[model samples]
Target chain A: MKTPWNRFDFLLLPLLGGAFILLLWHLSSHSWSGDLPDPAKTWHESKPYVLEPWAKRGELDQGILRFTFLSLILVAKGYAIALILGTPIGFFLGLSPTFNKAFDPIIQILRPVSPLAWLPLGMVLFAKIKGINVTEVAALFTIALCSMWPTVLNTAVGVRAIPTDYLNVARVLKLSRWKTLTKVMIPATLPYMFTGFRLSLGIAWLVIVAAEMLTGRPGVGGFLWQQYNALVYEQIILCILTIGGVGFILDRLMSVIERRFKTI
Target chain B: MSAHLELFNLTKVYPSKKGPQTIVRDFNLQIPKGEFVSIIGHSGCGKSTVLMMVAGLTTVTSGGIILAGRELSGPGPDRGIVFQSPSLLPWMTARENVMLGINQVFFTATEQERAQIAEYYLSVVGLADFMDKRPAELSQGMRQRVGIARAFALKPKMLLLDEPFGMLDSLTRYELQQVLIDLWRRNQITTVMVTHDVDEALYLSDRVVCMTDGPEAGIGEILNVPLPRPRDRKAILELPEYHRLRATLIEFLEVRAHHRPNSSNSPSGAATPPASVPVSA
Candidate 1:
C-alpha cells in the first residue's frame, strides 16, 4: 500500500508536465511555417495582448473588456436564476417519489436538447418584447434553461439518497417536517447538491458562450466571432485566454465556498 | 391514578406474501410512574416489537397503548425513544444534537435555559469535552452517550429503549449501564428497555419479564428482582438467590426452545427439565 508518491510528488508532477509539453511543441514546429507560432512565440506574441491592458490601466481594448464583463454578468445572473428555481424543484422531486416519477421523463427529454437549439426560439420570443433587450435576455435564458437540469436532477437525487434511518430518527424525535428538512435532510444531501451546483455552473458557462455566439451579442463569444471574421488572430487568442482564465477562477471560487461549508 | 405506561392486550402483525405473521399478541403490561422495567428474551422473541408498539412507532394490530391514561395514536414528544443504533445527525456537533429538540419542543425556554439544560445533560452523560465534536469524530461509546444525553434533555414522560446498549462493547456497556442507573435513580423517570442479555435485565430492572417466541409471543415468566439498591455485578453474582434465578431462567428458555409445533400436527419434542425441586417465585 505504501507507494512512492506523496504531496511533493503531485506538486512537482505538474511543473515537469508543462516543461515536457513545451519541449514537444518546440520540436514539432521547428520545420513548420512561421505563420503557425510555437508555444514560446505564441506566449511572446500574446503577452502584449494579455498584459498591456493591466499595465497601462485605462480600459485597453474596449471591445474585449466590454464583452468579457458582459459575458460574466450574464453567466452569474443565469446561474443565480438556476440556483433559485432548481433548488426547490430538486427538493420536491427528491422528497416525493410521486413528483419525481411525474417529472423524471420530462426532465430527461429536455436535459439532452442542445443549448444551441434554444437560440432561435429565445430570439423569436424576446423580439416583440420592447423593454428587455433580446440578445442579453436570450443569452441569459439559454444559460438558465441548460443549467437548471443538473441542479434539479442532482438535488432530487440527493434528497432521495438520504438514509431511511435518519428520517426515522427525525420522525421519532417528533421534529416538524420543516425542521427535519432544514436540519436533517438538507445537510445530508449537501455534498450531492454541491456536485450538481458545480456541474450546472459549468453548463451555464458553456451555454452562455454558445448563446452569445448564436445571438451575435456584445459578449466574449461575440467578440471572438468578430475577431475571427476580421482575421484578427491575436485578438481572438486574447479573448479565448480571458474566457478560460475567468471560467477557471470562477470554478475555483465556487469549490472554495463548497469546501468551507462541507464540515459534515 | 394514572398509569405511567400501559399496554392492554396489544398485538402486532406483518402482512406477508402468504398471510399475516404475528409478532406479539395479547401483550398486557403496566409500568407505574418512576418504575424501571427491563424485558429479556431470546432473539426473534418480539422484544423490540413490544417496545416499538409502546413508543407508537409501530401500529398495534389489536388493543391499545396508554400513556398516563391517554391512548397513543402515533409518535409524540411525551415518549422519548433511544434506539440500539446511535442515529445522531452526522452533520451536527454533540451540542447541536442535544439542542435540536430543546429548541422546538420547549420554545418557552430562554437561550440561557436551553444552553444550561444541554450542558447539564452533557455533563450527566460525561460528554462535556466532546460537546463540540461531531458524531464521526467521537468513538462509538461517545456517540451513544450523546444520544442518551439528547434523550434525557427531552424530559419525556417515559423512555422506551430498544436494545439501546446492544451495539456497545462489554466494558462500554457496563459503564453506560451505570450511567443509566444513576440517571434513573436521580430523576425517577419511567423506563422500559428491551434486552437480550440476562445480566443486563437483572442489574438494571426492578422487574424482569421473560418473553417466549412465536406467532403469539407473550410473557412466559415475570421475575420481581429483590436485589438491593445500588447492586454491583460482582457482589450480586455471589448471592445464592441470583444463581438460583439464573438457573431457573436458563431452564425455562431451554424448554421453550424445543416446544415448536411440527408439520405432523403433533406436539414437538419437549425440553423438559429433570424432576428437581422447583423454586417458588
Candidate 2:
C-alpha cells in the first residue's frame, strides 16, 4: 500500500524548501539598503577560502578546513572524556535507588546551567595546570562539563527501565551476576545509551564552538570571531554554513553507528 | 516413590496501604513424577502466584516447596517456566533464545551439543524453519512456541506454565496444546499448569485443582480425569464422562463457589471467574 507521499517526496520537499530560502536570502540582501553582503559578493569573496581550505598561512589566518579539523579534535577529546567518566556513574545510579536518590537532585541543579557560564571557572582552573595549552584545556573542560549530563541521565533511565520479564528470565536461568550484566543488562541498555551519546555529541559540538570563540583558540569558532572583529561579514557567513554542515554530518555519523549496534 | 514436587502450607501476603493482604493461604499440593496437574480458578485467585512460587520467581510469605526430596530456595535450572507472555528476549532470534537456556543449564555440554538441543526442541514445536527469526518477525503463536522450546531445551525435571496460551486464538491454542502434550509425554517431566479453561484442563491434565477467590484463596476441589492416554480431542468430546465433568466444574465456578456461606467479602473480593464456557459440538 503505497501512500501519496513517497520517499522521493520527502527528499524533494526539503531540497526545494532550502532552495527557496537561499533565493529569498539573495533577493533580500540585494534589495536592502544596509551593507549586508549580497549572496554573489559573499560567494566571490569567500571563493579563495573555500578552494584553499587546508592552507595554513598564519595563526589567525588558517584555512577553513584546518579550523574545522581543530574544532573537531577538541570536541572528540571532550566527548571521549565525558563518555569514559559518565557511563559507569550512570550505570551505578541506575542500578541503585539509594545512589540515584542522593545524587539526582545535584545532577538536576547542574544540568540546566549553560556551558558558557562555566567559562570563567574553567579558565581559572585550567590556567593553574602549568604544562599544556591553558585556553584549549579550558575549552575542552567547558565542552565536557556541558555534554556529560545527557549520557548520565539517559543511561540511568535505560537501566531502570529494563523489562521485569528479562529479570525474571535471568532468575529462572540462575545466571551468574557477570553473565546477567553482560548478556542481558548491557544489551538491553545499549539503545538508550546510544540515544544519550547522540545528544552528548551534539552538546559537545555546540559547546566547543562557543568555548573556542570565547577563549580565542585556533579553531573554527575562533576564526569566526576573528573575522567578525575584522569586519568580514562574508567570512562570518561562510563559517556559519561550515559549522551547520559539519554538525549535520556528525549527527548522521552517530545515527550510522547507532543502527549498526542496536540490539533491541 | 516420594512425591516429585510438593508444596506445604504455602502462603503469599502482600503489604498494602490498608494492611497485609493474603493472596494464597495455606495451599498444599503434591505431584508424582511425570504427572500433569492443572490449577484453575477465578481471576485474582492466586493460581499464577502458586506457579511463580514453584518456579521460585516469587517469594513465599510462609512455608516452602520441595522438589524430589530437596527443599527449594530460589530459581534454578531444575525447573523451567513458560510465562503468560511469550517473554522471549526480542533482540535474540528464536534459536538463540532457546540456546540461552540450554547453554546456561547444560554448561558442560559442547557448543555443538547445545545447538543441537535447541534445534531439536524448536523442531518439536514446529518452528524449525523459523529458528532464525526474531520475536517481532514471528506471529504470536510462533513466539510462544519459541518460549516453549526454550523451556523444554533445558530438559528440566519439572515444568511450570502460567496460562501459556491464554492470549492465543482458539486454533493456535488447540495446536499448541497438542504440541505441549506431545512434548510432555515424550519427556515425562512433572508439569503444573495454571489455566482458566475447564476443557483445556480436562484435555491436558491428569488432575484439575480448582481454587476459591482471594484475599486468602484456597483449594476448592481437585478432580481426577481418568481418561486413557494419547486422548484424541474429538474422541474425548464423545465420552459421557467429559460432558458430566465439564458441567460439574462450571456449576461449581458460576453458582456454588461465588456464594460461599461463611467467607468474608473483602474489598478486593469482586474478582470474576474467567469466561471460558465449554464449546458445543
Local distance difference test scores for all models: 0.80, 0.87
A12-113: candidate 1 lDDT, tens digit per residue: 889899799878767766766444457766677566645544333232334455567778888999999999999999999988889989998999998998
Screening candidate 1 with a backbone cut-off below 3 angstroms (N, C-alpha, C), the clashing residue pairs are: none
Give one digit per residue, the lDDT tens place, for model 1 in B1-281. Answer: 46788889988888876567776767888889998898887788788989888877788899998898788887776777788998888888999988987886788989999999999999999998889999999999888889888888889888888898999999999999998889888888999999988788888988888787654577877788888988888999999888887776677676743332221233221322232422121
Candidate 2 deviant stretches above 4 angstroms: A1-16, A19-35, A260-263, B259-281
Provide the lDDT at B35 for model 1: 84
B1-281: candidate 2 lDDT, tens digit per residue: 48999999999988887678778888989899999999998887789999998888889999889999999988888898899999888888999899888888888999998899999999999998999999989999999999899888898989999999999999999999999999999999999999999999999999999887765677878888989989999999999998988998898677654443224433343343223422111
Can you write out model 2's per-residue Cα lDDT over A1-264, one digit (the tens) per residue?
A: 587767588898999998998888888887873567877888998888789999988998888898899999999999998998888888999999999999999999999888889888888997777788888788878888899998999899999999999988888898889989987888889888888999999999988778988999888899889888998888888988999999999999998998876756
Which residue runs of candidate 1 sit more than 4 Å off their true CA positions?
Answer: A1-12, A19-37, A54-67, A234-242, B1-3, B214-216, B251-281
What are the per-model DockQ values?
0.44, 0.72
